[model samples]
Target: MGAIESAAQAAAWLLAALTRELGLFAAIGLAVGGLDDLAVDGLWIGRSLWRRATVYRRHARMTMATLPPPEEPGAIAIFIGAWSESAVIGAMLRAALAGIRHGDYRIYVGTYPNDPETERAVLGVGDARIRRVGGVLPGPTTKAECLNRIWQSMLADERASGRRFKAIVLHDAEDVIHPHELDLYDRMIERFDLVQIPVLPLLANESRWAWTISATYADEFAESHQKSLVLREAVGAAVPSAGVGCAIQRAMMARIAEQGGGLPFSADSLTEDYELGLRVRAMGGRSAFIAMPVAPGKGLVAVRAHFPETIEAAVRQKTRWIIGIALAGWDRLRWDGGVTERWMRLRDRRAPIAALVLAVAYGALLLSIVCRIAGIRPDWPDALEPILTLTGALLVWRLAMRALFVTKAYGWREGLCAIPRVFIANIIEIAAAWRAVLHYVPGTTPIWDKTRHRFPERVGE
Candidate 1:
């Protein structure tokens, strides 16, 4: 009887301690979330108001003028790094070659010697503009390393052809290139050192209504590329590269190489793209993320690609990003910049803490349901009331912004569906953040956690 009583008391104590911890985590996590949401919301409103007050009249004039692209297109080279991208490389190259509106351009694909399938795929494209550069490193090296080899090839190509590429473009095998993509890059790189057009992740062949692994990507990216990056560009904050649909001016890269004493891209980092953008800003180079329509008619010129569609695939892909950008980034790219920079950095690095908060929140939720079933009452914290109120409003605003952006990128159907996709995104964040911690703690070797790519077979297909 004493043992039974002791067991009951211990169990009660355990529950009480867990409940207390949950409260603390909730308080801290919600505070972070609230700040992030507020920043995003503030940026959104500020940008809108600014555009209305000033840029609207200029935009009207630009639209009325119908600006023509440069008569003599600048020499630009597109580089795609393929590790095991045999399935989509050929189709991507073909689609890109067909879609390019510019004349003076070249495409260089970095392939591993062991990756004969991808090499053959590139060769099969049969276009003189496309050159395959096999690297000394074996298959599955970091994307940055592969890109370095491609850079060397680009240098050799420029020397041979006697035409210096004004800009170097980066892309992935799965990307659906816009016809006006290089045109914009050519035009923008003439002014800004780095140019990033919007990246719109295409919906995988999934149910339009079903909340899938890929929809989370679509929802998050829609909000990010449309608003967050736009705001970052506006506020003079460092704009991290989205890996694809981005270009860097050759001159800027040359200056960057001179500064770094070798290559501009970090060969050791998993997210070299993100690091490049930040490093460029740190060195006082000009960069821009263009979201406005540059394509003909009302179409917003953007890069389209399908993200990971399965839960396992999405988790793996996101794990790499979380590890690279937040976990590894924290240690390698020690904090810099002023107030806004610090704030943005905090938002970028908050994923691990957010993950803990999410786990505790879910656990607390389950505990509440169990307590109800068992006829027990939870001792709720009184201090949480106001915080909860503020966080709740932030969450509503966030959801509205997400839905609006998703609608703008996809359509009304997706925008409405993005409301529920929020929960799925949270799940992905939790799983990926924990995985990132695990990978970072052990100092795991970084390699290409390549996503299986699917190319759109036809235009708008």
Candidate 2:
């Protein structure tokens, strides 16, 4: 009788443990479901508002008509990446041509060490205004290093010539530019120390892969450029910079140079553009986002970056970004400031917690499944049914909202289809978060992950 009672007690304890695990799994699933709904809905609403508020066509015309002339001849400095045949590059060249034809801006192309193909391409244009500069410093062979070297070289040249630039613009090789992009820059230079215009993605009729890349970029840019920046400005928060389509003042560049020519940022962060913006904010400098007016023939610019033809390449590129931005740079986000700073801090803080919770929930779900397979009974109370239903509803609503926003930014078909992909991506992102945590434990130099480009042969050529 004593042995039988002991065995019964053991069974009860096992049952209790199994019950707890099942409950935890249910709760977590509900929570994640709710978050998904919230993210989608919020993003959709925010994007829609941004689109309606900024009337691009009228703004562009107004800007062109009233803006002052270029501060001086060769006052504008343009930085172009030299590699590959990207749609973004084409757009940038078009913009450079426009600047040469209309604005009195001096264009400079900052490129890798002696690429004959790039040289041939640039020379083919027969434009004397565009000058190419090689030998970017630090010799790391990364974009950040290349950019820093270019900035330093440009500054040294300016100082030697006793001519200071009024404005500086960075362009990727894949960008498409409108004729009036420079005019927009001219007007904005009058007000803001740093100004950024919309960086749209190219829309093409061929290749679903192209469409996918373009649409994804469109969604991302719409959120970051239009909604987030506007909101940050309204709340007096530091507006983070995008990688390209950025223009800065000469005085700001000089100040950054004083800080040791480190790409205008204090730290060697993966998201260098964002870090630069934060540094600018820390120094009491202001930045603004300019609305790109879309008219019949007046779209500002579009880039075709990484139209990955294969799933493997897409995954590799995304993983590199994840490791760089989410994993390596997590700790570098500055949280000690005012109210805006506090909000940013909170956002960064919660991301890791969310990832952990997801991991825990997944673990619990696996435990629950295993216990059930082993004939262990779960003793969850029936009273929790209502709570579980409410949680699940919230989750579905959140996902629906995100889907709606994606649809508005891209299209319903692609956006809705991407929901599952987004969830999978979040799981991968969580892995990145864990990797970041491991990196912070000891002596770890940030690993530079390089993405290989796929330059497919042009169709019908």
Top candidate by lDDT: 1
Tens-place lDDT per residue, model 1, 1-461, is: 99999998777767766765676667667767877778678877888888988987675623212656655468888888998889999999888888888887888899998989999999999999998989777989899888888888888877887988888888988899888788777777777888898888777665654237777888888888888888888888898888888899898888877866567677778899998899889989888988757633566778888888877778888898888888888888878998888778877888888888888877877776766675555566787777777767777877788889899888999899889888888888899888888777535558887778788767665
Model 2, position 67, has a per-residue lDDT of 48
* Candidate lDDT values, in order: 0.81, 0.58
Give all TM-scores, in the order shown: 0.94, 0.72
**Evaluated with TM-score, which candidate comes out highest?**
1
Model 2 Cα lDDT, one tens digit per residue, 93-193: 65457534445666666555445556556655667667766663322345555566667777777779897777787766654444566666666666777
